[model samples]
Target: MPGERKAETMEEVDLLVCGAGAGGMTAALVAALEGLNVVLAEKTAQVGGTTSTSGGTTWVPGTHLSEQAGVPDKVEDARAFLESVVANRGGARLREAFLASGRAAIEELDRKTDVKFVAAAAHPDYLDGPGAAYGGRALGPVMFDGKLLGREDFDRVRPPRREFMGLGGMMVGRNELGALLSPFASLANLRSTLGIVGGYVLDRVSYKRGTRLLMGNALVARLLYSLRKAKVPVLFESGVRELMIEDGRVVGAVLEGPTGTRRIRARKGVVLATGGICWNRKIRERLFPAGTRDYALGPQTNTGDGADVAMAVGARFDDGGDSPALWMPCSSYTRPDGSLAVWPHIILDRAKPGLFAVDAKGKRFVNEANSYHDFAMGQIATGAIPAHLVCDAAFMRRYGMGMILPGAGNLAAMLKAGYVIEAKTLAELAGRLGCDAKVLAETVEAYNRSASTGVDEAFGRGSSVVNRFNGDAEAGGSNPCLGPVGAGPYYAMAVRPADLASSAGLAGDEFGRVLNEEGEPIAGLYACGNDLASIFRGTYPGPGTTIGPAMVFGWRVAKHAAGKLTDQPETVSGVMTDERTKNATL
Candidate 1:
């Protein structure tokens, strides 16, 4: 393939990054800062991919932010948490690299760029089982102004509409909501809310446009602004159709853009951060046979394009069984196009109290208030009839139900529509859902007894603030954790295990290099975010677990590609052409 005629194509860059999501953005920013000419391409018209739709929390323990917040986190504690959950799962080298590089990445972002970080005060780790801190381990992005980007016509990426509880009837974070509820805390929350409302109203009146509030959206805005400042050429609405390979190495890519087909070469590397296959129906049917109808909560553009392209180029993948990206239980509403806008928080408030999610034989399988990952895994492990959330009259009257507008009539309508079921008693409720009546009754009785004692002896239901947050506040007893509902009019609704996104893809080493079929690292190829198999394997250690690793790995990959490692060889030589060849040494 030597001296092959150069094909007519667009200009090349030092690095060509696909997918402008969190990982891709991080990689692009890092690479560009290292003096590499970078071009970041996104399939969507806008940048900030799924990160725009997330909570913007990154779980990194032993960081300076945590220390500044007065929550001391030790490396030993973090190691303990990892050992308790994800150690020895897979790719140990990668896990070590992640842990070692996470803090440095955060520091680099804070010092070199405007990516400010603040600890999510008091956010509990997912397990909280043992050696877990009650908050201060996770960091969230502070608010940034979108107007600074100077792209007034562009659709700025923001957090999911649900995560924004600000002015204009917006949503607030759980911690903020709790502060709003407490009398003393309410005063602070009130002041914050008023400030937000006042700023929004003034901006709207003066500018003749609604003011955009930042929470999670601030993370994306900051990244986008940084990318802009760095002058990284972002090709929007452009997707990689295939890896253009020659002489047994990747040279460029065939991109299907809005205008026409185009090929772009990469001088240094191609980073795959196109996200995972969460929305593809065919893949969903293959992976989740039972819950095929559940719409993914992530971006619709995530269709495993990167995985497919890598496979086409002779890359093997890990069998990420039972590990599809999952979201919380949601209710769907039909859109004008006759499709569905699936909401993610349907089961949180309504199903937390009297409702006990049971398997086929009517047995409680998991703590109701565990993280969504645990809850979804429980659904998968049950493998019986579809999970059911069992509830009572008190739960119905106080919490309302589902995604429908909160009202008694809506609840009745849902019941009539078969989305929810109701009966005069627990046995009757089980009978309606075709579950064993006696078993359900016993489960409810046991739960009620635990509620009376104020401690969930069975599953430690009230052990964490997350658990109590969703629990029935009015349930009285020595244990505010549980309350018995002996009253009539019980209910049950079928719940399907859902995912926020899938976490499996191309396998990478400690430096995020894509491995070939023979388990050898492919030079100049890197991956991060959900596009790479999770370093934790199947276990989630805490909140922001996914994003934290993504950012860390992204930085690692960028550094490695930029030849920052002193111990590593200065140069890795391989043929760079547009033709097929035998395996050659690097």
Candidate 2:
């Protein structure tokens, strides 16, 4: 509604960003740091969206983080990895743009904002198939303190404190988890725990500090503090309901807020970074029918608001493929609020041993220990509808099965709900699952033989720590695959392949400009993060692959809006017509 109505009492800015997730915040920060007038809006009362709830890793190859950690990498190496994964499906030009711009964007944020990067030495590129880097490409943000943001700033923006499954906060990295688990390990762990407890007691006696906290909350707290110090205007509890078009360009947006609806006119353009449609049940069912009901890890605000708003303004979308939403098994316990809780660690632990996940037909498909993204895709590719994670008694006892403890009742409940099943024999378990008893028996026997010898002959189960971390660590035999469930009372859990989020949406160029049906840019509108088809297409190249591309595109979109991309030739033509543009605003 640009020309139809008079521009009365309009608030103008160089950039109006939708969503406050990693992409949105990165866009806002970059634009603001470039000395542009920027305003960021979030649907939830928080600045960090899924990023706050994520592992906070961004896969950036040949960056300072990797270099500092002495990891061998270059821009070419990163580009090669992208090419190998995306193959011909993702355009080489777009991949090149992402690779070329990634480091600069990251370095800019590090130099100008409170955002700091640390190298994740252990994270690897997703494809071990070919041309994959060994390590030191992924980067995670340094931990920050929420208290540093002060009460006022903290109150204005909500951190993802209530999003964790049963834990109550975001997921922390290995260092943080190690610290928590260390206290339960040995003398060192005991000493560390005592030290923390002693410190708490002393602080309590002196009335100097409150309760101690750890993990994801601490990391988000730090990021929020930095945002506050940067003076970024994060309009929390404000959702972008519509886009404002002017002369075939995305000039502004209509924001729905707690106070009222307000029109934000962007002098430059609007950046749609509101994340993907992970929480929208209709969209989830349409895209991933089998796992829709079980996929529950994403942010509630990630309902494709940015995508919907953009589509309303004549933007086109692309579903990369019929890729299923990534899935992880969750606890069957119903909370007082009737929400399903997921235990990610349990899936990680159980799949590490000789246990193998099978489809309804009781057949093995993927490497059980692969990243959640690969496993999810494998399930879809293998035609697995409601896959099952089958393990022997030794596997269950070794990994403690489902949730750590105090929540073991949840597993029992799941077993009773037909969400999980247990039987003394393979044939009995197959009967319960309605699969051929002989097929399942053979599958288990083969898997057990492989496990006993420490080799996963069928699916390469012993590939990554991610897989081995959940497997039977003590299984004997050369292959380590044949850990026989002859111990009786074998277990099987009905695992609905779930996702952290859906990866399909409006397709965009490297600059984050939404493209039309003809593969031409739709001016005035830009999209990034989950709102756009993932840069890696459907395959997750490595850890933080989602956030890394999101940040890169977010930065690129803002830069392009600021006319920084003038040096680069337009790879594609504009598809929006004058008539369509006028009609959209009207």
Candidate 3:
């Protein structure tokens, strides 16, 4: 036993962060900035985790960026908004900690790290409630030049999902999407599209993927760049197998990687941010609702390693939330390479004009324009296990559905692949979907009546701000989310419930320290990102909710470890006053 232990290489650092996501990278970067020797371990060869593939919206309300964008917000307002919406599903203290530190976290990152964020001009809150802002609350990462990271580091950054990209590996943003989707719409659009495509073409000459990175790719690249700048050692393809305990305190961890097993001692603390339990089938079965499928949008490597090691100790899971996971309706099809590609139906076609979803019996179920989470919830509540998103041929050509691109000429290929069903008549479409022709025809007739009047009497399709914001205002007559599905042939794409990430995870204190079953902090054990229980308690309040809290708490964890934060209340670098520090322990 002694010889085996001796054979393992031992290393020491002030802080050891397990995970290479936004939260974990933030921890390592901050700790290193605070003059602490830090090491970051990523289970996979690539960094970024799911963040690289995400929209990279960080919802941190009441920041300087908001004021700069002329959409000023207040922390108190955000608190009131959360209190009204979130209620008592999660700890009030944790929410307060996030609220108090969010501005400071973003400000600190902007001032010290390569990470930069620009507030969205018009991104609305997913839910309408007291103290919610129209915009400025959500910030998107500034574009990053992937070439600046060099070929080796650039290659280390995880690529965005194939479904979200263009060409082979070009990352596209929402701003350029309109131009690229309709390049000849205007002179400006044509120029913009050309510039974007030209940039990608130039990028391909020297890079494996697009050099001009946006959204999650930009966020991950900035964090990765900052970590490298701070000289933090990143252990790629290394995972924490067990947390080494010394007198009831987490002192180190035994990690397994490509080379061999190694032990790293953390003098201050260790932070867990290894995505979550979304891919852990055993835990997924236990926590998720019955009949939920085994599919997650996150990388498959997120198999609960962080929770497993923490739970192996005295740490307990936080199972108190509206749901165990964040939901997204996904559809899958095999790619030309013979690999399966799962496409998340998130805020693209569902809320657009000329589309509607129906249950197995051909009855309209939910407000198709509702948020993805609420849409999935509607499916579960109404027994619409495999809901069908129906649209006319005109809609398919204009908006597309699931993985089908707008105005795409590959309809025949998709139909042949069974990703989409096409038919010349509503009755024929119903036959393919296994629904009664009479019921299907009647449902369409009723929906058409509502579309003509621009009033969805059944589901209130475009009544909300978010609904209209995501809808095609130029296309729909009165209600942007309402349009006639009359033009034939008809098409259908079935979507099933899939989680973008896990909300239920290890319980932790406001300081991001992992809590034991007795409701006390486990010494030197901290968590952030999906590894920690969601502060909002499974509520999808707004854009970037997950990433916002993740970075804030990660900042808290690092500051606490570096001895810069304490139990005594104090001002935090001019970002928070004494009043704001009441709930947070400095």
Candidate 4:
């Protein structure tokens, strides 16, 4: 039932956005652009949520950037792919709404704000299922010059976690990867490397963080830049303690900030973009699989605040699939500063030849070149609580494991730190890993044979053209993804299934309206980003699946509030205990 939203006793804005990630910021921006009074609040002192620590890739299917990148994508093709991959866990309508609005979201941000993006030349859908594009669909925010944010603004922007950044604070994007990997490969590489290093050196002279913002950090900076242009004050250290509902309609929230507690009212509604429930221990223990760990390299502030608030006000949870969260294999070690250096094995290591995950039996159980999410899922299926990511001496020296960059970082220091386990032979490595030596040797031989050829008969490693996106082209042996770990010295790292993002979230309608357990909207409450139930349920479809929907639905929520709702599918996301059941999109 729609109740009177006017709250005379509280400070009010036309729109109140909670969580300042890409989604929340987008909603605020849209409202501000439309001349609506909007206020943004973040739980942490920082603006960006998990998005600041991510690659900021959004899985928007059709866009001008895709055309510019020369990848032809059709809505039907993407729809087909989603149907095959999502498998009805989240229903068809929600996916359709996402597909329809995704491109428009990017376009609006590009046209109305400083947010700009470019399609990856070769990103692929995680699953080699139907409607997958080799590229042109996944888009990353174009790198932003931190100087444009100015020193004060740069200082305000949250820095990427130290372990995620290079040179302590410098951010490197896709454009700089090749140069950083092989500085002597070309004059361009040399020059680019020098430029980055020089800039970092100068930046360290005054700024506490690197001025070169890239990837997700860059994306957040861009959004913040736009917000600054709009003159929106994003209140930090302000966490929502409770949602105030009158006659079943969410009308306001009691916020706890540094100064004091205040009830803030929203005329339009509140946008919840709190990045997932990755760090919620109680939820993870109760709902997720046994032995599931929080080795997340994402924002630790994700305590399910948004979901909790909404659920307290009647929103339902969606955690009824084979898995309850998006998976990532993470490696972590404590730093001398008492902070943990956690590394998410999303990319930069896995697909780069000579790496394989093995169980205590020392046998390979999965395709080495598969996406991190799928690889982690496969690990969980095998019940391998601690899988070993093994590689040879040459491979380790050439391509380092998590938090241990190749051809750089102190390798011996890392080994001594137990960040990596080292041995002179497979037998010794197997002994260290408590796996059978003979079986490990045979597994290596079988894998090496496949590496000698271009085919992995056992698992078809690198069979998909998309696998090469995270692989190395310089060493395109029989397969660029395959390399014999037949060398004398070996290295291994213990990896576990880490929660990357939550697939289960609060249910919502097409207008970003929060839905109750009975499948009806809770008027004046909306959710975007990881706060809302994932459209694909627990399956990770492609790069930026999290951010893409977040931005689009955030846009949808704002438009709906502003009376500017356009062509949007009527149905949205909600609880579905069974994937086979239709109307999975509530």
Candidate 5:
């Protein structure tokens, strides 16, 4: 058997990281920086999995960024918040580990790599719990110029989702959205708009897409560029087909790549950071709740290959999250090219004044200003299979609905495509939406009464600080998240729940080691990213919850593999440091 297997080309590396998403890239980069010969393998041609198309917020509390920004936060308060909100699912240890090592991990990355982050001035935690903050916990990636990576190297990084782009592939960030929408609103906004558009125009001359990356795209680009500087080889279009185990230890992996089959011998360890089981139908059917539709925002390539291989080698999964998956309510419409465009309804219009979500029966179900996860939970709890986001003409024009822009640039096209439903009256709208006319009218009347008084009796819509932050500040109402739906010309868009990422994944220890059925670490095997069970056990604590832990644990895995594990928060400089970091006073 050994002789027969020798036919395949064999390569050696200290650390072999499978997947090139945020987590895997972090591991590869960290391992290289720690003096390990590391190689990253991606299943697709490009790097950055779901991360490239996401908002790219990383939520790690008590970091230098937070401190520099003067955000008031205490570790104990964060613990209290977690304890109050998260289910007691035996994940407290991992959660504690995350909180403890987060700062060090971030500082290390900042000191040794090109991955830079800026503290969000006012990005609040999802839930306003005891330890919740108004801002500074969530960090966003700094804007990156793709030109720095050069055109060829930049092409290897995944682009943002087409629906989120403008002018056929120009990426935009959440903060710049206001300026992009109303370029002439102010002189500053006009300059910003001109700069962005000008950059895009210039980029189109040489690149396939705009080289001005922002949000998740920028984060990915930064990581990729850093990996290049470290001279780490990221094998694109390569997949690990089998994990080579010897005497109960993972030794290496059998990879199938563009060049053909080969055996890569890993001297140190193998980190599995594949993007979880998002597109795995069999596992999804078993893990997901009954009646859930098959919709996920992650790439189709994430078919649970890593989990399958790990499970085959005696790894057990921890599927006990409060919810099996993290969710976002999404509305879909067919593009002109016959492709489906699924737009995630995150913070654009749902929380603004004069909007409410109703079930098929035309009765309000949840607070429109609640976090996306909570909003999806409300849909599931109330059996709102396809919830209708109702708003009047003025509201639609001021704040977009689904993929429709604020100006309703292509409203007729959207209506024709059945993406939006418009009617001249409440009864007509209700009839078109298959709701009871009387019930719909009564619901609107009750809502208008509460809107007039600036108080939502059924649900405290804008009572929370985070809620008001997303609402239009210029709205003429006491509650920015509550306003009366103007008369006639009502609009409604149907949305359904979709998994933003998987929470249930392979059981892993605090050190990022994959655990066997006996609850012991599998020697030389570690897992991070969505492949590892969420530390919060399926609860969304704040923005960038998934990505935050994915990166933190990724760094931990690299340090542990390189024999440089340390709990100290002291800042360290330089790359390829072989010395074990000493513990220092926090």
Candidate 6:
């Protein structure tokens, strides 16, 4: 074959990316700070995929961190709060390219690198609808010192989430879960729970894991230490088994990993950023919502492998939204080593002040401080699909259920491992959830007459601002989310709905490229976190609504793959071995 040279099984690069979360490491750290020639791959073996078990927040509205916290925001009031809660599902030019690249990709990744962030000046927006704000567009990540990712690259950063970590391996954050869950409330929450259990007993005698990296595992260990100080390689377990189309464009990717099958290429594109399609069960039974069930504990290597390798190369599938996933409500059990956990009710005991969720005729349904993506669609529009939540035993000995901890764990081995259930009455917790004990004591005497008049009047649980940002601001004159499941030995748990994020993806354009079904643009394809689509289609806006359009369309797919290079290098210098990137020295 004439001196057999077709670029020897190819492994080049001008940008390749594909799922290393936080929008594939902020589109391979802004296409390797413009110098390009990036790589990134990652299908697990750790590179912080589900954005390292989240809460790293990113929302981003009008910025300058809300004009230095006096709260600013306006891109026409974030386009009138995404046209009053994203009804157009990712259009209007991808929601005005996520309001002009969400504060210019967090002020150019904080002027280029240790990837800092701050703006949660009271995090709100999860819906006050039209131009909502309360807290200038979320923002979070300021705590990454995993010894600056060295100690063998900080043990490959991906901590936080052995069921949201704590004591048995540390890493707590969110203001140290309020002084380690209200340590006897004061004395400054007992010296912040003895300085967070003496810094996890001195971070377990010099680390093996907790080197103190906060949420979304300190934004994926500060974007994997800014892609290893802008050297940018990332590989991990690899993946993307297809997408090399030639004359049609997308020039590279056939990965697989551990050295089997290679073919990388990528002259100036290929971004994708998987982390979506919520554990795809044939795209969650063809776009969720009908007894939905991809069982979402997030990151089971988000099958939908970059939307089935970009819709098997002819991309297309935005399957619209409004709930193609992104709800919560999880609960599973098993842990005394047999592993199984799950948990995820998100927001500490559903905005405190006791709790509720019922049904099976025992009544009560949602608004237990809403937003767990609308309380799992208000338990499937109040049929309360497999519900229960309840709670008591003095709010389970000061907040803790679902992963059952407080007094630091074990409520009689989580009620003999049934995951939770205690009941000293409510007619023995409605005779152990078979419901009817006079309709669970008339739904706990009409929810203790709407918690002694803090007035839920059926479903108002601490009326909004994200339920006073997850309630209990010193629960004083009651309704800090209406507490009053008063002291019974009660408990409960047993719930359903899951999928933390998927909301139908693929379909792109205002620069992150990808798009088909005749709408055009697939050339050298691209996509950003959760592989595009969701421009609020499934609407869960704020508190980092899906990492602020996955860091603003992964910095608009690295400035549209650096403007399809006509011989780039007029200055993309973050130094990926300069010399004007002589074909990235392949």
Q: Supply candidate 2's per-residue lDDT for 83.
A: 69
Model 2 — TM-score against the truth? 0.85
Per-residue accuracy of model 6 over 1-586 as CA lDDT, tens digit each: 1111234555688888878888888888988887888989887777876777878788878878788878777777777877878764546656665675577678878888888888877778877777788877787888877876767777777676687777567787756676677688879888888876777687678787567778778888988898889999888888887777766777777788897877788888788887878777887876676654746757776787888878877688886576766778878887777977787787878778877878787778778677787888888666576788887777777777668765526788878878877778888788888888997777777877887888887777887778867878686746777777776788888777887767678888767788877878888888887777777777786677887788777876786688621232332322222332333221
- Sorted by TM-score (best first), the order is 3, 5, 4, 2, 1, 6
**Candidate 2 residue lDDT tens string, 1-586:** 3223334435888888888777777777777766788888888876667676566678777777788778756766776667676776755565666776777877777777777778766666656645467667778777554446655554544444242322333233443344444466677767765665565555354332322333334434554555566677778788988787666677788888999888988877888888777776666667665545645677766777876777776667666554534344443444458766555532345455546787788888887677766776676666675677787766665544554332243456556554457888888989988999999988877876775666777777766544543344555444333355556687776555566655678878767888866777877778877787776666677777777877787787777777766444333332222331222112
> What digit string (tens of lDDT, one per residue) describes model 4 on residues 15-128?
899899888999999889988999999988888888888888888888778888788677668888888887756546566667666777777787889999988778888877
Q: What is the per-residue lDDT of model 5 for residues 227-247, given as tens digits with 9 covering 90 to 100?
A: 999999999889888888777
| True-structure lDDT of candidate 2 | 0.65
Top candidate on lDDT is: 3
Tens-digit lDDT track of model 3 for 155-181: 999999987889888888867887988
Q: TM-score per candidate, in order?
A: 0.84, 0.85, 0.95, 0.93, 0.95, 0.35
Q: Give the residue spans of candidate 1 off by over 4 A.
A: 1-6, 128-131, 150-154, 158-171, 176-215, 280-289, 292-294, 321-327, 335-337, 345-353, 396-428, 455-458, 463-480, 486-493, 566-586
The TM-score, computed over Cα atoms with residue i paired to residue i, of candidate 1 is 0.84
Model 4 residue 258 CA deviation (Å) reads 0.6
Ranking by lDDT: 3, 5, 4, 6, 1, 2
The global C-alpha lDDT for each of the candidates, from Candidate 1 onward, is 0.68, 0.65, 0.87, 0.80, 0.86, 0.76
Error of 1 at 506 (Å): 0.4
Please give the RMSD to the true structure for each candidate, in Å: 6.5, 6.1, 3.1, 4.3, 4.1, 21.2
Clashes of 6: 1
Better of 4 and 6 by lDDT: 4
Whichever of 3 and 4 has more TM-score, that candidate is 3
Q: What lDDT is obtained when candidate 6 is compared to the true structure?
A: 0.76
